[model samples]
Target: MEYITLNNGVKMPIVGTGTNTYGKVNNDYNGALTNEIPELESALELGYRSIDAAIMYRNEHLVGRVLAESTVPREELFITTKVPASEEYVSSKDATRAAIDNSLKNFQTDYLDLFLIHFPIENKEHLKNTWEVFEEYYEAGKLKAIGVSNFEKHHLDELKEFAKVKPAVNQIQINLKQPNKELLAICKEEGITPVAWGPMKAEDHQKEVLNEIGKAYNKTGAQVLLRYQIERGVVVIPKSHNPDNQRANLDLFDFELTTADVEKIENL
Candidate 1:
């Protein structure tokens, strides 16, 4: 695994596993769902040091359970979670306090490597109050770093004006189809690392674009896509239930892409 230093002076894994899921599945506090959902333990076994979960995902306890069984040490791994995407909690300091406490209990960890404001709220004032809680956690050493997710330039601009401590990261969607060029530029300028959520888009089965790229390097379409993002200096989290893909995603370090190959795929 590779590492990058955040503005706040903390090291994070450049490539990692992100446990970001959206659904209203019924499960116990430890995330034992009847549905055949992807298991977090498999990721741990495959050497994923970072786990991204959120209160909204409602699987923090389950994430904690997987970590507990893993051989990895707590300090060696980076864990991040997000607040509810609304002004309701941010407007009330009391609400923010309760939310953070709940998250800690759910994840079963004493400290968080990173925590982010899920997104800009409808009410601007609420954003200020929300950031206040994030700062508080940082000062207390409970949270090593803090950041924002799914924020555009306008959203980041507003936060930067009032942010006492700069954001360390901005998690967003980035893939072959969605390069998100403009937002990425702001992050590079503001000293925040951009972490991409969807690194692979199911192989683009319909498009010959992926197949063409795959042929050049003797790699699969999945490998080609992930390598493309890594070339752009973006941290990606590509999930898989199959063991083959789990191993394939980690096999990127062995090969490098040529300049022309990168340009051609970027056009696609």
Candidate 2:
């Protein structure tokens, strides 16, 4: 697997597994809840070195269980989590620090490869405050890098006016179906790597591109889609509870997508 370097000098895996697939951690929207989060041990055994979860996911303890039993060393894995959005979209520095501590204890890891503010909240001060606290943690050795998720370009520009530390990464909803071109350009220009989530859902771009591309290489639609993203310098986290799917998610190393193929896929 290939890796990307964060602005802070930490190596982040290009592909990871997301834990919140069709499930609500502890909260229900309006009146509905969903399936239980998947077992992490299955994911770890399937060759996933990175696990992405959030406090809202409420699966930290479950993730911890797998980490303790896995054969992979702590240094070889990358774990990314986020701080929950409280009232007014603001967070306390001390509280954020405490949250990091709680995360370390929950995941049973010595440190985190990445920590991001989950969502854009109300006050800009609170957002900057959260980053400041993360910066402290990064210096103190609890987190290797810090970033934001789902941030619009305007939100990022607003933060840049006074941000002490620039984000090392920005996780967003990106795919051939819902590509946000402007935000992507801003991230690339600002030196923040963009991570693409929800790539294989039915709602994603049709498999015609994948199928056509696969014809040239004899690969699956999923493999073609992931390779396309990584070729564009975007990180991806495609999740699956099935063993074959999980292994397929990591099988992008065997083939290379051609420039014309990439352009053809991008054009469609």
- TM-score of each candidate? 0.89, 0.89
lDDT for each candidate structure: 0.77, 0.78
Instruction: Write one digit per residue (lDDT tens) for candidate 1, span 1-268.
Output: 7777888779887777666441214423344343333456667777878788877776677677667667889988899888877655676878898888887887678888989888767577788888888899889988899999999888988887788988899999887667788888879888899998887864354246666777767888788878878777787877665557777787777678888878877777
Report the C-alpha lDDT of model 2 over 1-268, residue by residue, as the tens digit.
7898877788888989987642443433232334344445667777788788887766666666667667888888899988876842245777777888888888888788888888875587777777778888888888888888989988888778877779898899888777877888899999999987786643345786677679778888879988888888889998876778888889898889888887877786
Off by over 4 Å in 1: 21-32, 35-38, 202-207
Q: lDDT winner among the candidates?
A: 2
Relative to the unseen true structure, what is the Cα RMSD of model 1?
3.2
In candidate 2 the C-alpha lDDT for residue 267 amounts to: 80
